[model samples]
Target: MLILVTNDDGVRSPGLRALALSLGEIGRVVVVAPDRNRSAIGHALTLDHPLRAEEIKPDVFAVDGTPTDCVNLGIHGLLSQRPDLVVSGINCGLNVGDDISYSGTVCAALEATLMGLPAFAISLDTSLFSHADLSVSTRFAKKLAVDIMEKGLPEETFLNINVPFGPCSGVELTTQGKRNYGESVVVKEDPRGRKYYWIGGTENGFEDLPGSDCNAVHRGYISVTPLRTNMTNDKTYAVMQQRSFACMGDID
Candidate 1:
């Protein structure tokens, strides 16, 4: 089996290396990842500028683009054969709650799902600057990859896996949780007296939503949330169908 491995963390990331090495024991692994950290980039495609990929080592390619671009290039341009699975991360930090919408790690898996491939993004619920050993997360990722390949993901659906630091209590299937985001922008003055702004915010915590990824991770369990590429709200669609907008006929 050919497995395509990629991450939002740069190609040299310890998490990425650990993931690729662990999964290599199961199948042929090809790594195509961003040359630099592109965290929280979402599902952005580099259409405005040309992308460049360099094979820094055998079976490893570093692309000067987002995690989504790496997946695209891996499946279409780099590998000779289609991969059986696409696994993003073993990311340094967690991608739970509303953060998945802004996560390049999760978006990489989403891109693969859009291309009709089985995929999952795995993250470690730890600080990005921490040098925690990734053996546990990598092992679980390998196991999960095998399971995904054997069982097959639901149609148009991928997964978001967040493994807590240290020993895990167990694994739990969860839903996307909600985050309580406060003012995230930080204003500052540069040495030149010009104002500059930073985007990230202090962690404000999550909603008390049980059976959610955030909750599961907080309880020392690996959180596995099945995510779908289809963004349509079925309940809203059903409600809109019953409401007749006869006023629309008055448009000039």
Candidate 2:
């Protein structure tokens, strides 16, 4: 099977390298990732500007675009054959709850799913400089990837896997968790009297909602949450159909 690997932390990130090495033991691994870190870019694509893909090594390419662009290019243009699955990350930090909404890691997997392939986005909840042993995390990610290739993911669904900051006990299938960011952004001034902002210095608080990704990871387990490309709330659709706004078709 052909497996395409990528990450939001750039092509040279240790986590992405570790994941690629681990999955290489299973099948053909192709790595196409961003030339630089593109974290929190969500599911955006580079439609306005021309995307560039450069071959950095054998089966490894770097793209001057977002994570989504990497997967789209890999499957459509770069890879020698169509990949059976596309896997993103072993990212440097966790992507859960609201973070997934803004994560380029998840967006890479979303791109693969849109292209009709089973996909996964995996993350480790720690900084690279920390003494976090990535062996277990990468191994688990490989195992999950293998399982996905064997069992196959549902239509339009991609797995978002998040590992906690310690040794793992086991893995859990979970729902997207809730993250409450307490004073999330920091306001700073760039050069030339211009005010800028940075999203740093604070952590998002979470709770153990049963069967949630946050709870599983908090308990030192790997959290595997299946995500969909569509953001529609199915439960509220019927209610929305019943309500009517009367401001259409008449210009008075």
| Per-residue lDDT over 73-140 for candidate 2, one digit per residue giving the tens place of the 0 to 100 score | 89888987899989898888899888898999998999899889999999988877257788888888
lDDT of each: 0.93, 0.89
Clash list (residue pairs), candidate 1: none
After TM-score superposition, what is the CA distance of residue 252 in candidate 2 from its true location, in Å?
4.8
lDDT of 1 by residue, 1-252 (tens): 999999998899889999999999999999999999999999999999989999999999999999999999999999999999999998888999999999999999999999999999999977763658687798899999999889998999999999998779999999999987788888999999999988875665899999999899999999999999999999999999999899998999
Report how far residue 173 has shifted in candidate 1, in Å: 0.5
Per-candidate TM-scores read 0.97, 0.93
Give the Cα-based TM-score of candidate 1 against the true structure: 0.97
The window of 10 residues in a row where model 1 has the poorest summed lDDT is 125-134
Error of 1 at 2 (Å): 0.2
- List RMSD in Å for every model shown: 1.2, 1.8
lDDT at residue 55 of model 2 (Cα atoms) = 86
